[model samples]
Each structure stands twice: as C-alpha cells, then as structure tokens.
Target: MSQRSIKITMSAVLLAAATLASTAPAGAAHGGEPLTDVRVATHFDLAAGQMPENITLLPDGTAAVTFAAGRQVALVSPGGGTRILATLPAPADGGVHTPVLGFPLTTGIARTPDGTVYVLYATGTADLTGLWRLRPGQDPQRIAALPADGLPNGLALDAHGRTLYITDSVLGTVWTVPTTGGTPTAWSTASELAPTGFLGANGAKVRGGALWVTNLDRGTLLRIPIRSGNRAGAPQVKASGMAGIDDFAFTGRGNEVLAALNAPNTVVRIRPDGTSTTVLDAADGLQNPTSVALRGKDVYVLSAAYTTAADPNLLRAHLRGHR
Candidate 1:
C-alpha cells in the first residue's frame, strides 16, 4: 500500500481500536453515482486535534459521536450544536496501554429506543477495557469487561433488549453479553474472522434475523444467522473484496447496505447481489469517512480526516437516487 493508504489504514486501525475497545439509521436507499453535493453539519476545533470515530443516531434525530483520542462522547444537535455528554477514564495501568497505533480511542456508541446510551472505550490496559451504560443524570455503569488482548469494536442488541453482541477487531471474535448484566461469552469464533492485519471483525448490526459484520483487514462482510435461541449458526460471506470496510447501515432496499470504506475515503451502496456502486467518494469531499447513520430521510456521515490539518467533520448529504 502507498503512504496515503498506510495513513488511512493507521487511522482506521486507531478508530477501530476505539470500537474494538465501544461501539445508524434507516431510510429508502438507492444506488447510483457518487454524491458530491455534501454539506458539513459540524466541525471540531482544529486545535483540539480530536478524532471522531463511530456515530449512532438518537431517537429524536440528533447524533452522538465518539472521540477516540479524547476519551469522551458528545451530543450533536440536528442543527450542529454540540455538548459533552460524558468523559471516560484512561486505562488502569495493568496489562498494556500503548498508543503507537492510537490512544484513548472510544470505538462505538449505541442508543436504544428507550434513550439509554451504551459506549465502548479502549482502556489500553487489559482489565480496564470497558463497556459502559449512561442513563439520564446517572453515573456511567460498567456493564461488562472484554478480554485483555481483545479490541471490542462494533455493537448490536436484540429487539427484546436482553442480549448484546460485541465484535473484537484485534482478536476477530464476536462476544455475547446479557443486557441485564452478565459475563461476556464467545458467540462465534469462525476461522474466517481471524485477523489478517490490524483489525478483523469491526462494525455490526442486527437485521433480517441475523448479525452482520465487516472485517477491516480482509475487507469482507459476513453474516451469522441468529438461531431461535440466540445461538449463532454457521457463517456465510455476504460480500468480499470490500477492502477497508468499516461500519455500515441498511438502506430501504432489500439487503442493500451503505458501507464506509475508510482507506479509500468513500461510501458505497452494496446491493443484495453483492455488487457495489459509489454513493460518495473522495472527490465528493470524503476525507476518511468512518461512519454513516440515517434519521428518517436524511443520511449523515462522520469523517475523521486524521491526516489532514483541518478538524474532523460530520457531513449531511442526500443518497443519490433515494430522494
């Protein structure tokens, strides 16, 4: 890979480090040419050098973004006003806390229909890695702890709000934990999930009675059927060669997904038939797009721009051929 590709990969790894460490929305989606008419809804203070990683939509149409290096989560209003929601602690200094790849990364954040917020942060120390729950006017609660060597990234919860699925990017493992509080157990350990580079299993979402995941190093998207008893059945490749794939959201179209390709700085509309078309790309002002989320008819993208002098940005744009 070229130097630019290397930088993008590093940024993705660091951002992924956060999700592997926390871990969008719906709309009528269509595939077409790249979307160039993008608008920036918010931009962080360039001097802060904050890297905004993954994003989850709030029930009221606002957004919450994770700042990996900053160790905090912020709420961004629909009109772009931002306020800090919570500040996370650094690792407790036990196993290993290194920042050669990235430091203080907050990987993923999710919100349920009931307005409860869940966040994953890389404590760097083994036992310090935590998945936390933040309720209204309450201190964050530690729900569960992941493995020392594992980087817990993407997150998904069942409809009944009883079970939660977390993806480990470094170890390429999927873990299961009870929302009511319990130990996290391995849900799936298929060989296909083995890490090929800096990351393995990353973003995840529950749809169509299964859990969908993307592998960063291998650039493959896989689905593991969720059996009747919440057991993960055999795995299947949904799409491949989607290099640098990070997080994605389902479109209104059957089995179609809007995927964020981090290294290439683009978002693609992957069809049910496993084909993909660019919806927005580098030329469309995407500078390392890390996450995408939808609220009603609007689609929002979070671009980290890790290599740029400008601060990270969140852009709002229309999905080509969707409106």
Candidate 2:
C-alpha cells in the first residue's frame, strides 16, 4: 500500500507498517482498474428472527454477534450457527463501583490483540449500562460505562491494543480509553473541527496515521491525523455520499470504505475522493443493513430484513431516498 492510502485507511503509521511489511507499492490495495459489482464472498445464514447489532471475530476465527433482544451474546460458528452465552452479570469490586452508564442496549464492541473482548451495553439504571470484559474462565467485569442517552456506537483499537477509540453519539465527540484501568478521556471534540459540528459520532478506526470516523446523521466519513492520542487540528471528510450511514470498514486494500446504509437496506463502496457507487442496491442482498463487518475478503452484514431480485420497489426506493 502507498503512504497516502495507508494514511487514508488506518492513519499514516499503518501505511508505514504496510510498506515496510510489503513491496506491493502504491496501486496495490487500490483497485488496479475501475471496480464493479458488490461481491458476495460468503454468506453465513443465521436465525431469521435474531437481529445482530454488532459483530467481532474471535481469536480462533469464530464470530461473535451481539444480540439486541436478550441477555445472551450469540456465539456463531460455521455449522453451529449461534450458541447463546449467558451475559455474565456484573460483579462488585471493593467499594469502587464502575458506573453502569448504559447497559444492555449493547452496541459497541472491541478486542485486545490477546482476544479479550470488551462489550458495552446501556446500563438500565444510569447513562451507561455496562462494560464487560470477557476472558476465558474469567467472570465478566464491568470496567467502564457511558451515559444512558449517550450511545456508544463505534469501537477501534491501536496496533498494540492498549489504546481504544470510542464514539459518543449523544455528545458528538470521540474518546480514547486505556484497555486496562482508566476513565475514558476526551480525544477530540467536534467543535474544533471545521464544518463545526458532527451529527452523530457512530463508527471509528485508528489504523495505518489517520483516525477514521463515521458520522451517522450527516451521512459522512471523517479523517484526522493521529499523534499519540490527540486528534489535534481539524479533521477532513473522506466521503459524504451515503444516507443513513452507520458503520464502515477499511476493506479491499484500504482504498475503499464499505458503508452500510440503514434506510434502503443498502451498502455502497466509496472512493477516497468522495465518489461513490452503489455496490448493493437495496434489492441486492440487503434489508436495512445496520452494520457491515469485514474479515479478509468476506463481509458480514447485519440487517433487519433481506433483499431480493425481481424487486423494483427496493431498488427504486433507494434511488429516491438514499445514496
């Protein structure tokens, strides 16, 4: 990957890592030619009624899907599909109570390099519900929480996994927290960035010298230079052509951002210069796809419904209402 592409995708450092690690050069991850079609590499079918809010791949390559309806996080395997794991109850530690700012309406998820899983839920009692660290044989512990109305939308980690990036939709800001012990501190405030304000801070990634964030209400993607933990100066929008944009991933060599649009059940591949092409029209294997998770060349999409061919209503609806 080229320096600019790496900087664009993960942050410039990741670009350096890629170049030092490989000799593919600039035009590698970027499509060598104009791209066409939304490729369906694999489809792992799950239960029809179970909706997945967020997804993360385990160390063993197993995929974990967070459920919106139950106390169980579904452990999905190739053949087993989904095995319910009881949501470990929060334990009391000393007199130091980890505030349950938002529990149970779990949305954000991240993992350390060692496979420790951190899941955030809306704590029913306060602004934050629960922050749980799930380690094998270790009872889940509530480490941190966010405000009740403060929705934690995106989660990302550094190369070493010590630092975590989180987005606060209600506050329209981003935070950097230590994976070990610490109250999440402000990393960047939206007001300092030009365009002045953010609609809703949704998804985030600290990869390759840039910090990539998703602004849901604004239907845009943003980038900021990474220096230590500070976002410092203003951030720039990488792309702004989707409606109801929620989450995005750096896939296909880091030049493309695949965004899952909520309304028309669509996913679009956007370029670095803000141009976009609808890879999956609402009629193509999508139905209110809330999130898109990438694992290598495959993509796991969470949707409220399914999209099908022989459908004018689905595709036309997106043409009129979305990007």
Give me the candidate number with maximum TM-score. 1
Q: Model 1: per-residue lDDT, tens digit, 1-323?
A: 13344345465655543333222121123244534457887887534535677899987778898875666788999889888888776665522343234444678888777788888866556555768888889877778987756778888787777778888888778988877656888999987777775778888888889999998777778888999878888888998766678888887667888888776666877778777766776655677778888754578888877665354788887655564
**Candidate number achieving the greatest lDDT relative to the actual structure:** 1
User: Candidate 2 has what TM-score?
Assistant: 0.70
lDDT of 2 by residue, 125-152 (tens): 4433545577766766767665544556
Model 2, residue 323: distance off in Å is 28
Where model 2 places Cα greater than 4 Å from the true spot, the runs are 1-49, 88-104, 127-130, 192-199, 229-231, 305-323
Q: What is candidate 2's CA lDDT for residue 63?
A: 67
lDDT for position 95 in model 2: 10
The lDDT values for all models are: 0.73, 0.54
**What is candidate 2's local distance difference test score?**
0.54
